[model samples]
Target: MNEQQENKPLISLQNVTKTYGEKTVVDDLSLDISEGEFVTILGESGCGKSTLLKIINGLITPESGSVSVNGQKIATPAPAESKLVKLRRDIGYAVQGSVLFPHLDVAQNIGFVLTLDKKSKPEIAEAVERARKIAGVEKELLTRLPGQLSGGQAQRVGIARSIAARPKLLLMDEPFGAVDEITRRSLQDELSRIVKQEALTCLFVTHDTAEALKLGSKVLILKTGKIEQYDTPEKITQQPATPYVNTLVNR
Candidate 1:
């Protein structure tokens, strides 16, 4: 990548807005996320953290404005399904509860996207092995079904699946939320290592302040669909931009 391209934001949102009935979920939000940044979106429920992720991923169409991922505009008015599919394939997504296909074995689950894309068996196998190693999934567990795995194992499998496609951006919505505290910490440490090793640009949503602070190179504090503060973790802790930010960082 050229220096200019490397310096440019990998993801950009311009005046994006989303509404459900009479309620506005994301209200005229604008932001730019640079390449290789791990941005943690921290907010209370109903603050549009998940909505923002969906919008970027082209899963949720906004009421107005534009979004660009890797310089390609998305979520346009009535986008083609094929285009959305292509876009989503380039962006990895993992959510809470480790939603895996119960019928698929661990290897199949991680290779699911590759299967859909009709990748060769050898290619799929290679991708699955690389992803599992990165996500900390054991080789022996590859033959086990999702039902046979523990919660932590299932979650790791979910992560492996998301990254198997080698996406440029990763969107994670509280991926560790359902696990026990000890498991959560282990997952966090593993994820931190994985992100660095992969040099991924990630947008991770979490309600936990400490998790946000620890995982994010930049922390985005949201309030009712608006940005309260978008700054480095150190700056946020030292110089909170608003009273709400202060309360969040303090409490």
Candidate 2:
């Protein structure tokens, strides 16, 4: 990519809003995320962090405004399913819990997307190996099912599967929430390394204030469906924009 292309935002949201009955989950939210940025969305429960992620990956359609990923318009008043599928293929998504397929063993689970794309056996094997190494998944576990894996191992496999396709964007929603502190920290370090090495843009959602600050290059804090603060982690700590943010920082 040229300088101009690299300078352009890889993800853009404009006047985005999503409502369910009387509740407005995301209200007129507008944000631009540059390529290769690791943005962490930090918020209280029901504060629209996950909702915003869903909108970006085209899992949830906003009631108003627009969303563009990789310069392709994904959300309008109505989005085409075909376009959404194509867009999602380039975006890796992993959420809380071990969301692996029980029927598929580790290798099969990690190679699922590549298999869907009709990749050859050799190509899928190579991608799966790369992903496993990046995510710290053990090669010995390839034949084991999800039910046989520990929480940390399962989470690692989930991450490996997400990156197996060499996605341009990775969306993780509280991916380390269930793991032990040691495991979570290890996973965080591994993820940071992978993001830097792959030059991948990542949007990671977390309710943990410390985790958010530790992981994100840019921290975006939300309150009741609106932005509370968006800035560098250093700036957020040094100069919190709101009392809520200040409390979070202190806490």
With candidate 1 superimposed using the best TM-score fit, by how many Å does residue 70's alpha carbon deviate from the native? Answer: 0.7
Candidate 1 Cα outliers beyond 4 Å, as residue runs: 1-3, 90-97
For candidate 2, the per-residue lDDT at 54 reads 89
Off by over 4 Å in 2: 1-3, 90-97
**Best by the lDDT measure:** 1
- Cα error, residue 130 of model 1, in Å, equals 1.3
- Lowest summed lDDT over 10 consecutive residues: which window, candidate 2? 89-98
lDDT of each: 0.89, 0.88
For residues 6-124, what per-residue lDDT tens digits would candidate 2 score against the true structure? 78998999999999999999999999999889999999999999889989888889989999887788877556787667667755443333588999999999999899889999999
